[model samples]
Target chain A: MIRTFYGTDTLNSPAAFFIALTIGFFFGLTLERAGFGSSRRLAGIFYFKDMAVLKVMFTALLTAMIGLSFCIGLGVIDPSTEIYFMKTYYGAYIIAGLIFGVGFVMSGWCPGTATVGMASGKLDAVVFLAGSVLGSIFFNELFSIVKPLVTWGQSTQQNMGQEGLAFVYNSLGMSKSAFGFLFTLIAVVCFWGSEYIEQQHSDEIGKTGYFNTPFLRAFSLILMVSAGGLFVLDGSVNAEKHKAVSSSYGLHMSEKALLRDVASAVDHVEPEELADYLSNQDPAVIAVDVRPAKEFNAFHIRGAFNAELPDLPQFVQHHTDKRMIVLYSNGMTHPAQARDSLARMGFRNVYLLTNGLGGFIERCLKPVSLRKEPMPENSIRQINLWRAYFYSFDNARPSVIGSNPSADSAKFSDMPPFLPGFVDADWLAVLMEKPGLKMIDFRDQPEYNTNHISGSYAMSIENFRGVLDGVPSMLMPANVIAARLSLMGIEPVFRFSQKRR
Target chain B: MSSGNQKPYSNPYLAGVFLGVVLLASFLLLGAGLGASSGIARLGAFLSGLILPTHTFSSEYFGAWGEKPLHYYLVFMLLGVFLGGLFSAILSRRVQKSVVEKGNAISSKIRLIYALTGGILVGFASRLAGGCTSGQALTGGALLLTGSLIFLICVFAGGYAAAYFVRRQWHD
Candidate 1:
């Protein structure tokens, strides 16, 4: 990953301060070595004689510019990650430059070089430095007077349409590479021009020239710097590109290692083992029942979190990673899909229950279906014990139908939107005890007699259907059905009453 | 490696390459470049606050940096500038005890007065400009900032225009 410290809490620290000091040391050394410590050399630029200031400054500018261009091209330095560009204040820079220029000729020192000059034991540099500090205080003291002048043409540079030459060149259909090449060309030409002018000036003055470095040394150094810049930036370049692509595809997992993880996650846990975890209240376990609310309310394992299909993402987000998520359903299909989907999304903790809850009931609870193969005597005893606890209530029978089912005793919402035919269990429980209403069970006679809603009339499916070309259909007259319901103490009258305050 | 009584300054181009490497190191390691004017402004704020804390704290300009002026990275860099220059001067035998530099034509008192005036102008202008020569010219100029480039050109123009008037001060 690319590391950049800017616009973040980590940007400032003791370490950053140390780095700044080191760089400043080198900067100061370079300035002093280039004769910036002496104001005479700097001021000679104005006299059109010593072009060292311009020459040295331009060389540094071009080197950095070319180096940065290469860094950007190779994707080593991400400007967006770390670089901060100073806002342009056109009017302020112009006004400030005018003032600074006059000061430059008079004092022969700028702020940074003056410090270096002062170090050289130049008494004038120290005095001038103190005066500059005083001037800074004066500016701040009368800021309200200067604010208007400095703030003029402040916000226009942001658009860059009428400002930066790069924008103009780009808008004219020239690519960045082409522009960079042209820019480098211009810099080289300027470098040559400065050298020619300085040579003429040197001849006129009958003095030694400013630069005396051998051609090969300078040329080789430039090549070596360029190569070093490229080499350093290359490692993070590919990493950044991979990051962009991975994020675009919505995969945060290391794609290279994901297949191995997925291969191992296919291993499933037995229902008996899972029940032991639930009984022991193992905190590492998470049970997710992905079946419809009605089905889940009818019967589901204890401690399972219920969620609709569409609510899976939000549900998982709320309870993820802290434990081993065990997903199961009435069958394996939906649970398997949910587990695989979660795992594909970089969730490593999700697992599937083998054969689902149906297989669990068959293998561990059904007494008659016990396998003939040799089994542990203690395991059999434990299975029978759990069977009594889990399967004692006949969830399929719905013994107290409208009352809370055994799974309803487990945590789950009562109302399932897909089961629009059934009234809410809470509402139906209240209405079952009402005087005028009669609850009906339109199932087989044996099914109703064994277990039904309290005080509900037992009836067959045929009462609500008739033979139409040998196909069962709803053809009963409304009055006939009303009379049948009235005979069972159900009123046909509609109740409409208003309550008074 | 001329360890002698005095040596001429290094080749300007070679010195500049060294400067660029240092600047690049700054960008890579500190996410910043060399600067000076802000340090002086921050010093001003620190000093003014000592005299009139409430006034410095209330005013918009000084108030921004008045509370913790020296906390800035640039202040440390400026300190380094002082130290590094001293170290280089000592090694090169260029450090003098107390030498007043002035043209043969100008009196020491007059030269001192000119230096003070010029320093004041540059100091105030650098703050208004948001950076000095090293900050704006080298750092921002290399970044190809339009305002900085224009400022660099204008500084030269302004200096040339003013030099005609001050020519007598420098004439020997």
Candidate 2:
């Protein structure tokens, strides 16, 4: 089978070397930007003065691993497409890694950093580099003698090598998803542990002002580019698969008819239609409350059957022909959300109570008790018509739109209206024409590789987030975002689309 | 100048990611991951071959190294690494000549000696194993290589163990 470009095939010889050099340069730049070249700064890890290293590394790894696993779970890329570095002399690598780690902590410089140190005019770094070269030569000379011991009694066939943690996980009979979950849990624990350690030794490490350095910034940019490369490669290969999974997941969650906030509510229906349902419903029309049990118990519409969210599927399955399954939530959003989810599982006639329970109370229940003010009637009719139209098509299960089922699935969503604000083909073309707009697509590996908006560089969102400190919240400070963008050659003034949100 | 008194370093997490990407790219373009020792080894082999060709070729260890050309892929990669590092340092205006040793602890001479010794030990250990710390620990660890994990754990353990004895070298 012809595997995609983002995997091992992408790392072939000259390409790999060039990639390494380019990435290395950027990595060095980011390291400097992050203040990595200074030994005292690095020693902060040991003294517990700072824990940026721990936070950034674990987050990056977790993000990438999670994204990778999601892609695998969605079957966008075959898990076995790349060769993981596992077949070598295990004993040798372990011993080497341990020694290297010790050297790292003590000297505050690894092989990579020592060179960067040399570049920054640190004589010690230069000396260290010299030592490394000599060390490598010594190893080469001694290789013949150590070859037998290196191989030991390990099977020769095992030398064929494995790829990623999945092989180890599969060998242990655990599912990839389970392993991914476990790894994430462990990483979170490690993150917490690092923080605790830093807190414990806060005084000794002092306030290390390393966060805003040029070295670190440059280092982050390099990572961003590398991630971009991966994203472009991976996105192109599995864009459709990702779209499919996201849509499917969206649909499944939608069935609960629960809206977390008002924004989601506004996306579906107006308030007046829900008022109409309250006035028109017959006594026999079973109004099922499909929110959480706690929510139902706290306060729900009067005369509503308490059916919890998870139980809705089972309830729908058991009660095939109920008079009218009118699902209501706190707002108009939940009902619309729930309708999609229920429809995916073969449920039909799922209706969102327009205006939700709030609307019903204001429009229908209030009129019976007190003299009510006159309300506009046209808005009520529009709401009813909207609800009726959706309910009619509820049974039409059209194979769940936006779910990519084939390897060769064309990205129909890549069309004009669906283009991301900063990353449309036209926007990219314009940016490319500019001196230095540097459009970066922060998607996953497969999606970017398959077909990114033309001229936009692919960088996995995980990598970008990793190097950028963390994922930027929707309302993050613009300056911080701009600073990050500047590192990637993107202008601070470029308007980014908020549509993806 | 006192290393401890010097400005602190960049965030390691970010650095690690940067390092990972470089390694990834090396794998993609060069069909090999990053290795510091190999570059050093090639240089050593070449130097030894030129200085004492007969002895270098005859020796069990050094002899095998001299068989290969000096300017191999690893040598070029290492050269690029130095250039890249230099470029970044120059651009950032961080280039300044200085000796980096811990503050007011061990004298400069001792620090240099220790650095040399540490380098040699790390170098030997890297050879004993198939790759160096970067290759095995960061790169391999990210890839979830079992040996790499073991190596990373051991490095921490070893460093901590040695740290206590070497406190004089760093602690004020």
> Which candidate has the highest TM-score of all?
1
Per-residue C-alpha lDDT of model 1 across residues B69-142, encoded as one tens digit per residue: 78877887888888888888877778876666766888878877888999999999998888888788777766
Using lDDT as the measure, the top candidate is: 1
TM-score of chain A of 2: 0.37
TM-score, structure 2 vs. true: 0.50
Model 1, A205-289: lDDT tens digits are 5565534336624653564455445444554555655664465355544544444334333436668668778766788887888
Candidate 2 per-residue lDDT over residues B34-142, each given as its tens digit: 5555656667777777877765655555544434545355555566667876776666667777866466967877776666666766677766665665566555555
Candidate 2's docking class is incorrect
| Model 2 lDDT tens row, A347-463 | 644666666777755554443213222123543555455444323333312223333334333243433343222223333343354554455777443334434566677553433
Candidate 1 Cα errors over 4 Å, as ranges: A1-12, A155-179, A203-206, A210-501, B1-4
Worst 10 residues of 2 chain A by lDDT: A155-164
TM-score for chain A in each prediction: 0.42, 0.37
- Candidate 2, residue B151: Cα displacement in angstroms equals 1.1
Off by over 4 Å in 2: A1-17, A50-53, A63-84, A153-167, A170-173, A204-501, B1-32, B54-72
